[model samples]
Target: MDMRKMFGFLFGLMVSLWLGVSLALAQSGYPQPTATTLNDFAHLLNANDAAAITQLLTDLKNEHGIEGTVVILNSIHDYPTGDDTIEAFATHLFNTWGIGDKADHKGVLILLAAQDRKVRIELGTGYENQYNDEMQQIINEHMLPAFKQGDYGRGLYQGTRGVIATLTGIWPPDERPVQSGGGSNSPTPVTTASSSRERSDGRMGILIFGAFVVIVGYLILAHIFGWPVGNSRSDDDDDYHSWSSHSSSSRSSSSSSSSGSSFGGGRSSGGGASGSW
Candidate 1:
């Protein structure tokens, strides 16, 4: 072949390969934010589960004026942020969607990557301090267990409830039996019963105490800054069998309907954490 023709052909081949790779990468990346009504782009959760979660989120917003959403994706390999860490991708999404009220900047995004076995709770600027460590614990303790068990719906539900409970000052149900201590001398029957009750109360007291500490700390900070308690900020994974793909058509149609949804102009400074199960 002539030198000019050879160079042209090589250039064309390179361009074609590059375009193909770019298109594939785009396809693999996270789906664009479409619906404001609980996006399940990866189709991880069933319709019933998705509806329930959506209602929970909506109620949280309506009753508490807190803005939050759950996002489940198949993978983050092609996340537009190009950051290997799920944390970055989540933060980017949180900001991109403006998940919270613009004035309050209070937003929480629960991002779960099923194939990647990763999860993240990304918070807006208002919630950085309030939702960080405790939120991490919730993901590690509540969400990761369900995910590891191949229960994405349960995992997301539990995780969402955990966040709500934390914010609403409610404690999760405890199933552990209470213990009673007694001396070598036999105690009165009433005393024994009371002791057991006291121990049970003590367990609840500890949890309340912990929560009180957080609330008081938050209040003090708020008072010092002349702000209110409504402000706050808001991870993990495991390996197991992958969920079967189903209802793609429904999901796509939902996404299209939700395309009109937009962010509330909220922003984030990379607040929140991430984890894997």
Candidate 2:
């Protein structure tokens, strides 16, 4: 019984106790064992278990042919409790639904659909405001009603349906559900020119902003160096205009003298010719 030995024993005891508690909580929380995902879906499909077959069919419904989605969220708080929290439930959902693993860093997942137009929701137990209960509420009030009334095929059809509209600022009325499509007959939505234009314009705006910054820097540098902005011609201080004027005057004088000499020579030639002939 030295102090160091006692401390070490206490630490070990705490770790063991925490693990036991977590295991217990998980069992109580989800009495049935967690089912495998698509990775295990294929195996379950071939497996003889009735329960496994049902889960696979559920996966098919959750992971059907949806693509191009959007989601917006304000905030979500994460529970610091052990793995038995809502986060665990969410991980289970994502796996069954074929949504990839995601970080629970911010309790909020403003999930912008990467490729598949399906929405996946995850809530952390840490958030009191956004605990599993609230999420269940969203599912029950907003989500489930759509599914039950519209039919799984007709309801959101897929997770992305209503969520996409919400992101696009056109969420269906509270009572309505998103339409579903599958196989070859489903009509693909044609994106309007305006949205395409907006995307292009957003890119152009970035480029233009960058160019403007460069031009401003160029002007500042030019001002500092006393260089002209564009196409500048510098004049010499050493009589550039004066030199041109002086040269022109000299040329005029020479021309006048030449003319006078030619006239005098012509007159002399005429007078001398009369005498010599």
Candidate 3:
């Protein structure tokens, strides 16, 4: 083939490939939320479960003025702009949807990425940072167990209730199960400010001690090797499995439709805990 013809063909092939990839990426972007309370894109929840959760969130908003959003997706990396880290994705979605009241900033996002085996409890900036530990406890004690057992609905429902109970004293209705399992799997009470501070202090102390040990070891090694140790190195650091059991319309008509104005222009500054099951 002539050089000119070969060059033209190659250019066309590259352009076609680029266009195809761009189109695929555009199609894979994270879905915009349709409901204020629950966006079960993975279709994991049953009708009854969805309705119950919706009702709880509605009551929560009415009584406490706190907005809650639950999102379940197949994978965090399935879409463009979706983060591999549940924490990042949850924060982005929380802010993107404005999950809480703009002025009060009382918002909570419960995200379950099924394929990724990760979950996150993202809180709005209105909350204290210590709440992250409580969130972590919830994931560890309430959510992961049921999830590991292949009970996504129960896991999510219980986790949502845990969040509500932590934020507001009101727990879920007695009729519905508050937690998924028994045998020493009960949810832990939210940590007090004093306790959280103590834990933080303890962690800091351990870190300092560890750093000191490392420095001493490095100095000894450097002296023995007769090396110049002038260099310093700084190191800086849901849910789709159950969809086939029911129909989409069934889910939408239940809890999905209940969220009229799902979010309230609230924003989160990446305050939450992430976990894997």
Best by TM-score: 3
Model 2 residue runs over 4 Å out of place are 1-115, 120-133, 136-141, 144-199, 229-277
Candidate 2 worst ten-residue window by lDDT: 268-277
Q: Between which residue pairs do clashes occur in model 1?
A: 126-232, 127-232, 127-233, 128-233, 236-275, 237-276, 237-277, 238-277
Write candidate 3's Cα lDDT for 48-82 as tens digits. 67877787777888899998988877676655574
After superposition, candidate 3 runs with Cα above 4 Å error: 1-28, 177-262
Tens-digit lDDT track of model 2 for 57-80: 233324531112112111111112
Q: What lDDT does model 1 reach? A: 0.65
Candidate 1 lDDT tens digits, 77-98: 5344476878878877777667
In order, the Cα lDDT scores of the candidates are: 0.65, 0.31, 0.70
- Choose 1 or 3, whichever is better by lDDT: 3
Superior candidate under TM-score, 2 versus 3: 3
Better candidate number, 1 or 2, judged by TM-score: 1
Best by lDDT: 3
Residue 148 lDDT in candidate 3: 81
TM-score of every candidate relative to the true structure: 0.57, 0.25, 0.60
What is the Cα-based lDDT of residue 66 in candidate 2? Answer: 18
